[model samples]
Target: MRTAILVDGGFYRRRAQSRLGEKTAEERADELNKYCRRHLYHHGKQVANLYRIFYYDCLPMDKKVYHPLLQRQIDFSQSDLRTWMYAFIEQLKKKRKFAIRLGKLADEQAQFLLREDITRKLCRSALQVTDLKEQDFLLDVSQKGVDMKIGLDIASLAYKQQVDQIVLISGDSDFVPAAKLARREGIDFILDPLYNPIKPDLFEHIDGLRTCDPHFNPNWSEKESTE
Candidate 1:
């Protein structure tokens, strides 16, 4: 049976950092393939056909701003962290089975005003006005259109009959609808929470709740270590 592996890039990175520890771009790129293949065991046999691996992520935020934590002016383009992340993405793109999907990161305050809670606290003297800082007013950057792209790809995979099964590496419940549709289309939907237990409702939509994390289940990994 042909299977496809899909990943939420942000989710994968955060969990991988915690679970697998930090890895260079080359190491991460190699593990990405290994983790995708670990799920092929169905009824005790691996599926030889891996259709492809789809990874969705946003470009690093590029901005010239004052760093609140560092207390200095900084250009995002010149940041070491940003440079490393881009290199990681580039390494991922080099893999033939992997497809990188790009989205955008939006600065919330660019379109929205300061949060009401902060305003209220300051008015009530709960927060000293003198203590107000630029970081306090700065808004968080959020990924935009990543979920929609994932859903669209799920639909395309199902409707086109590109793969009979899909292994998704994500914790977000945003995939519920897409999973339902794929399951209805007779595609086996498997979810890998990467060491985290997903919401109860999420388990109902997927045909399998399997994870490759050795920490989650020691015995399973012990018996099956090659993957």
Candidate 2:
């Protein structure tokens, strides 16, 4: 049976950046893909077609310290949009014999705008950081819509029986409901967390779960050389 692995981009990036703070985006992506492929094969599942990799995230603002192109990628949230739109269209098709309904603004699109608003508000807050005082308000670089996207994809895949197994690489409890549904539908769901304790809610729904050991893998310092 073929396996389809879904990755939460925001979750992956945060864990990876915390570990490999000095590594370039290219390095991080490469390592992440490598790790994912290795783990998938470890479970004796062949990755047929590498089905839909819906990267759920939002865009970073221009003023943000993060890379601009990377920010653009976040803003575009292309992969997330692709899957979301595809689901919407599929629903429309099933509802009517010849449905041609246009899709509306997505949850991610709204989140992107809201996050930008929050960033501006944080900058204006009176509790500004002094030279000696650390800033209390942390700005979020639009990483919303990920949970929703992940939830939608899991449910859709389970309903359609797209793959024999679904491997999720996220630690968020928000996915518990969708995972539960997948399990009820007899889909094998596996959760792979990035160096975080798996929540009990996840266990209530998924077929199996495991954490990546930073000690064995040493998520950090993959290489001393910089890009």
Candidate 3:
């Protein structure tokens, strides 16, 4: 069977950081490639040949934004995040059978908001306005064209019958319409949420739900230990 792997890059990065620990850009790219390959196997045996791995993400914001807490203009073009993101994308480009689909950040909508914990503390009067720190705020940037690109690709793949199966690594329900279309085209649709809990309604839309993260699957680790 031929298989295409689609990844929600933002979701994957967040999960990987929380579960797999922090790593450099190059190391994270390598880890992502390996993780996608694990889905090509079933019950310890190869079941499909990889068609390609499509990674979807928005390029980091590179515009200057006014910081509310710091009361200064922050130039994201010189930020470490922008540098690391470019390096990560370059590494993915060098990987065989990898395709990168880049979306863009909505520059006008970009702003900093207090973190959830910080917000709660302020509301309860546990913290004063002066207690706010730069680190307590997060940049809230909206992504554009990512979901559209993913949906378009899924429709194209299904219509062309390019692959027998398509595995999507995302937890968002926005792909439900595309998933339904793929199913009608007789393509096996698999979801890998990386152990994130999804709504029950999502179960009916997928042919299978699977995650290849060894860190979450104890059986996989046990088998590896014995091998």
Candidate 4:
């Protein structure tokens, strides 16, 4: 059967870090591709055309941030310069702590302020705050779009019937509707979830589901790194 591999780049990257140890984007893609090929062949479902690997990621302009690492690769610098403005905003959050004086407020308000002080102390001791560079902060802010892009592409590919089977390598529940549609269309939906298992509702929508263990394999590298 013809098979298509639709990748959620951000999802894969984050999950891969936990399973395969920390790795760059290119290394993560290499590991994922290797496992995918071996799994497909093991199931004896190959032998036909393997459709193009569709990677769904937002454009820099759409994200409103130009990641230097990505921009350097494309040789497109000087894009989205205001992305670093997040640093200024973060500083503002740290500096704007409300203060309360016992004599200036009523009894109930003073008690409320005391509780707030305890909570603030707990927060300060528990959570570790750190600054982010322009690229890192932009990635943190623009991560929501990654899931939307993945869901949209899943529905698009199934509606088009570009391939017989779709290998979705994600644990996102957002694709539940698309998975259900693929099932209705008689398309084999194989979910290659990361170490984190897909939710029960999402699995119920798919035809088949699988997971990649910590063990590494070969026979899946189409070219060099796929980033």
Q: Pick the candidate with the highest TM-score.
A: 3
Cα lDDT tens digits, model 4, 186-205, are: 78888877656556666578
Question: What TM-score does model 1 achieve against the real structure?
Answer: 0.78
lDDT for each residue of candidate 2 in 43-124, tens digit (9 for 90 to 100) = 4665344554444544332331322222433333345535444553344334321213122233333222223444465578
What are the RMSD figures for all models against the true structure?
A: 5.4, 10.5, 2.7, 16.5
The worst-scoring run of ten residues by lDDT in candidate 1 lies at 107-116
Give the Cα error of residue 33 in candidate 1, in Å. Answer: 1.6
Across 34-138, the per-residue lDDT of candidate 1 in tens digits comes to 778777765568755889999998877777655554466556677776877898899998888889998888743323234577779888999886776665664
lDDT of 4: 0.53
User: Which residues of candidate 4, in runs, are more than 4 Å off?
Assistant: 24-26, 43-49, 58-140, 215-227
For residue 90, model 1's alpha carbon misses the true position, in angstroms, by 1.3
Candidate 3 residue 17 Cα shift, in angstroms, is 1.5
Candidate 1 vs candidate 4: the TM-score winner is: 1
- The CA lDDT of each predicted structure is 0.81, 0.57, 0.93, 0.53
Q: How many residue pairs clash in each candidate?
A: 0, 3, 0, 0
The TM-score, computed over Cα atoms with residue i paired to residue i, of candidate 3 is: 0.93
- Against the true structure, candidate 2 has what lDDT? 0.57
Query: Alpha carbon lDDT of residue 135, candidate 4?
Result: 30
Cα error, residue 182 of model 3, in Å, equals 0.4
Q: Candidate 1, which segments miss by more than 4 Å at Cα?
A: 42-45, 66-73, 108-139, 215-227
